[model samples]
Target: MSEDPSLHQSHPDIIKRLKRADGHLKSVIEMIEAGRPCLDIAQQLHAVEKAIGQAKKTLIQDHLDHCLEDVVGPLPSDRRRTIDEFKEITKYL
Candidate 1:
């Protein structure tokens, strides 16, 4: 299957967010090692989830802006199928 080129595009803000999330995850691991409180660890996990969700939303928006632009022309069927697949894959997010 052809890939969406927009999905491969890099954004500095997204990279920064991902790096922060990585650091948060590392902190979570350290907390667990140090026998930190369960509630505090859970809060960090939640923050990681929220950050990932935000990144996914940004990527989806970018895909719509770039890849979906040509989805309504002559090859509408193919484009619709591709979009349906994209939606299906993104549903788990």
Candidate 2:
């Protein structure tokens, strides 16, 4: 989370994306119940997966851009190492 005016600048967009994914996930559940073809369901699931992935990426990057970047320069080696680890983890997002 960030400070002041708002926390996590991209939070709104990420929330919207998650909401869309939630709706899509519900539809996918309905498709399964209706015996929709596996291929079509798989395609829809793929879309939902991508949407969630994008949202995750946005969240991680936003934290990196805002929260962590708030530090003053000349960070201690331990803090630098931790930040580097976090950045490395975000690459998987």
Candidate 3:
């Protein structure tokens, strides 16, 4: 694996997003405990999912742009490989 990029840049934003999702998940649990309607629980769950998904996307893209650049440098083949790997991984999201 390549060295991580300056965590200074992406870490805080990723943490913030994850934290928001964490809070939302907690609320989702509460909603379930309170016997909230299915639609409302589903909506909150979706929001949490989106928040976590966005965080993951941001982290992956940042790593591709920064950490992978350091490892691969200007080599075209290496860059293409990294990009392809990134593209392949993003399919699950």
Find the candidate with the highest lDDT and give its number. Answer: 2
Evaluate all candidate structures by whole-model CA lDDT and list the values in order: 0.76, 0.86, 0.84
TM-score (C-alpha, index-matched) for candidate 2 = 0.73
lDDT of 2: 0.86
Candidate that scores best on TM-score: 3
lDDT of 1 by residue, 40-82 (tens): 9999999998887787777776666566655644456866788
Residue 42 Cα positional deviation in candidate 2, in Å, after optimal superposition: 0.3
In candidate 2, residue 21 scores what lDDT?
98
Kindly report the root-mean-square deviation of model 2 from the true structure over all alpha carbons.
Answer: 3.8
Instruction: State TM-scores per candidate.
Output: 0.66, 0.73, 0.76
Question: Sorted by TM-score, highest first, which candidate order results?
Answer: 3, 2, 1
In angstroms, give how far residue 72 of model 1 lies from its true place: 3.7
Selected candidate, larger TM-score, 1 vs 3: 3
The TM-score measured for candidate 3 stands at 0.76
In what order do the candidates fall by lDDT, top score first?
2, 3, 1
How many residue pairs collide in each prediction? Answer: 0, 0, 0
> Model 3, range 1-93, lDDT digits (tens) per residue?
235536737878899999999999999999999999999999999999999989988888777667766776676785688677875686566
